[model samples]
Target: MRRRLAALLCCLLCLTGCATLAPPYETPAPASSSHWPAGAAYPTLADNAGPLAMHLPLGQVFPDQRLQQLLSLAIANNRDLRQAVIAIEQSRAQFQIEGAALLPQVDAEAQGYRERRPADLSGTGQSRITSEYRAGLGVSAYELDLFGRIRSLRDQALQTYLATEEARRAVHIGLVAEVASAWLTLAADQEHLRLARETLTSQEASYRLIQSRYDAGISSALDLHQAQTSVDNARIDIARYSRLVAQDQNALTLLVGSAIPANLLPEGLQDIRIAISEPAIGLPSQVLLQRPDILQAEHQLRAAYANIGAARAAFFPSIHLLGSFGSASAELTDLFQAGSLAWSFTPQISVPIFDAQRNRLRLRVAETERDLLLARYDKAIQTAFREVADALAAFGTLDTQLQAQRSLVDATANSYNLSQARYQQGIDSYLNVLDSQRALYRAQQELISTELGRQLNRTSLYRALGGGWYTSEPS
Candidate 1:
C-alpha cells in the first residue's frame, strides 16, 4: 500500500510541475509617438548620427575628471542610493522565501518526552510514568501547487524583486545627475562671486575719483552720489554671491554625503566643464521603455499580472503533502533499533466550496491592480518622453542664447568705455557714464546666468537621455 502511495505521489509531483495558471505575459504597446518630434529644437539625424552611437558611462559623459571622481564618491556614499540598494537585497530575500514554497521542505527531527499519568486516567490504582523517544526526517505541510497557486505567487515575488532592482538603478542614475548639477551650480556661483568682486573694485575706484572731483568743486554732489550708488550696489552683490557660493558648497557636501576635498570642489565655471558626449536616442517610444523608471513600472505591471494568476488559482483545489519517515521507541536505547523503523505519509486536499465570495473578490482585486499598473506604466513612458523632449528643446536653443548674451555683454562693455571717455572730456554728462556702467553690470550678470543655463541644460539633456547608467552596446 505504501509503495503504491509513494508512486502515486511522485506522479502527481511530476504533473504539477508542468502546470501554470498565470496568463501569458506580453509587453504592453507604448501609447505614444514612434519618432521624436520634428523641429529645430531637436537634433537632426546627421547631427546626432556620429559619436552618439552608444551609451556612455558617467565618467565618459562628464569628461571632467573632477566631476567624474565626485560622481563616483556620490554613488558610493549617498544615503538615499545606499538605501535603495539595500531595498533590492531585501526584495531578493523575499523572493527567495516565497519561491521556496514550490518545493518540499525536509527537516531532521528528534524528540524525547516523559509523562506522568494520574491513577484514574491510567486505569490503574497507582500513578504511572511513560517515556517516548523518536528521531526521523520529515516533510512538513508543503503545498503540492497542483493548480500553480504557489508558482504564481513565486513569480509575483520574482517580478517584484526585479522591479526593485530597476528602482535602484533609477536611484543611481538620479544621484549621478544631482551630484553633477550641484557641482556645476557651485562652480557657477563661484564665478559669479569673483565677477562681483572685480566689479566692486572698479566701482570703488570710480567712486574715489568722483569724491575727489566733488571736493575740488569740479563735480556735482549728484555725480558723487551716483558713483557711490554703483559702488554700494557692487558691494551688495559681492555679499549676496558670497553667501550663494557658500550655500552651493554646503549643498554639494550634502550630496556627496561627506565633506568634499578642496581640490575636488569646483573653484569656478571654467574649472568644471561638462562635455557630455551625446547618446543615441533611438526611437522615442523605444527609448522611453529603456528608462529605468519605465522599466520598473513595467515590472510592477507584470507582478500584478502574476497576482491575478495566483488569485485565480485560489478558486481551485489545493493539495498539501505532510509525511514523515522516522523511528519511534518507548525507550531511548531502542530509538533506532532494527524493530523501530517506521514511516507514514499523509496528503491533504482542500477544495474551496463556500468562501462568501472572498475568492471572487480577491480575483477582482488582482485584475484591478493589473489594470492600474498598466496605466501607470504607460504614464511613466509618457513622462519620460516629455522630459527628453523638453531637454532637447532647451539644448537646441541654449547655445544660440548664450552667443547672443555674450555679444550683448561685449557691446555694453564698449558702450560703457566710450561713455566714460566722453564724460572725462566733457563730451557727455556724468549721468550718461552712470547709465552706461549700470547697463554694463546688468549685461555681465545676464551673461553669467545664461552661461550657467547652457551648462545646466547639457547635464539635463544627458540625464534625460538616460546616459551614465550603462555602457554602450551595439543596438
Candidate 2:
C-alpha cells in the first residue's frame, strides 16, 4: 500500500512536457499611425531624443508643497483607489485557486461499517454479525492535465490578475492629475473673487465722486447712474465667484476623501507651481504602450488567448486519478494490524464523444472573446495616441496666447487711468471713463482665465504623458 501511494505521488510530480492547443500570441495589428501627429499645430519637440515616455513622479510634475500634501491625502484616503487595490487582491486569490486545480488533494479519511444477516442468508444455520474499520490517506479525482487544460486556465487567471494591477496603476495616475487640476481650479476661483472685490471697492469710490459732481451741477445724473451700474456689476461678479470657490472646495474635498485642512489649501493661481518635464516623444507604439490603460488592455488580450487555449484543451480527453490506502479488520482493534492492509485505485478518462456541439460552441465563444479583446486593445492604443497628440497641439500655442492676454490687460489698464484723469480734468465726458473701466475689468478677468487655461493645459499634458505618483507625501 505504501509503495502504491508513493508511486501515485511520483506520478503527480511528473506531470510535465504538456503543451496547450492555443494559437501563438502576437500583438494585434496596429490601429493607428506609427508616428505621433505632427504639423504646424503640434509642438516641435527638441528633446525627443530621450527614452520612451514614462510617468514622471507626481512631485516632479506638480512642485507645489500644498498640492503635494493634497495628493498624498487623496491617495491614502480615496475610496476609488481603495476599491482598485481590493480588486487586485481579489484577482490574485482567484489565480491561486485556478493554479491549485493541477495538484492532487491528499487527505486522511476513516470509516466504520456494521451489518447483520439471517442464518439462512449467511448459510450458517445461525445469525451472524460482521464489523469492519478502516482509515488512511486518500486522493480524489485529481486531473492529470495531459492536454494542458488546467494549465491554460491557470495562465488565464494569472494574466487577469496582472491586468487588475495595471488597472490600479491607471487609477493612481488619474487621481494625481485630478487632484492637481482641482487644486488649480480652486486657486483660480479665489483669484477671481479677489479681483471682483477690488473692482467693487474702486467702483464705489467712483460712484461717490460722481455723486458729489452731480450735487454741485458739474456731472449729469447719467454719469452718476453709470457709476452706480458699474458698482452693481462688480457686486454681481463677487457673488458669482464666491459661489464657484465654495463649489470648488467641495469637489476637492470629495477627491481627497476627507475634509481638507486650511493649510493644505491653495491661496491663488499665482501660488500654484508646475514644471513641464518634456518626455522623449517617440514612435506612437512606444509612447502608447507605456500608458497603464493600454498595458491593461494588452494583458486582457493575452488573457483571452489563454481562455482560447483552455477551450481548445476541453475538446481532448481528461484523466482523473483516485486512490486510497489503509488497513481493514473485522475487529476494530485489528484495523492497523500487519496482516490487515488494504488499498484501492481508480482512474477515470472522459473522452468527449458527443455533447450537442457544446465543446465546439465553447471554442467558438473563446475565439470570439479573443477577437473582441484584440480590437479593444488596438482601440486603446489609438485613443492614447490621439490624446497625446491633442495635448501637444495645445501646449505649443498656449504660451503665446497667455503672453498676448497679458499685454492686452496692461494696455487696458493704462487706458482706464488716462480716461479717468481726463474726466477729472473736465476735458472728457464721463462715458469715456466708464467704457475704459469696463474694458479694464473685462481684460483683467480674461487674463485670469487665460492663465488658468495655461495651467490646466500643463496638468492635461502630465496626464497625457503617462506618469505615476508615490502614495505618500513627496519629501
Give the TM-scores of the predictions, in the order they appear.
Answer: 0.94, 0.93
Q: lDDT of candidate 2?
A: 0.85
Tens-place lDDT digits, model 2, residues 126-197: 888989899998999988888888888998999999999999988988898898899999999999999999
Predictions in order: lDDT? 0.83, 0.85
In model 2, where is the ten-residue run with the lowest total lDDT?
466-475
Distance from true location, Cα of 6 in model 1, Å: 1.8
Best by lDDT: 2
**What lDDT tens digits, residue by residue, belong to model 1 across residues 380-404?**
8888878887877777777788899
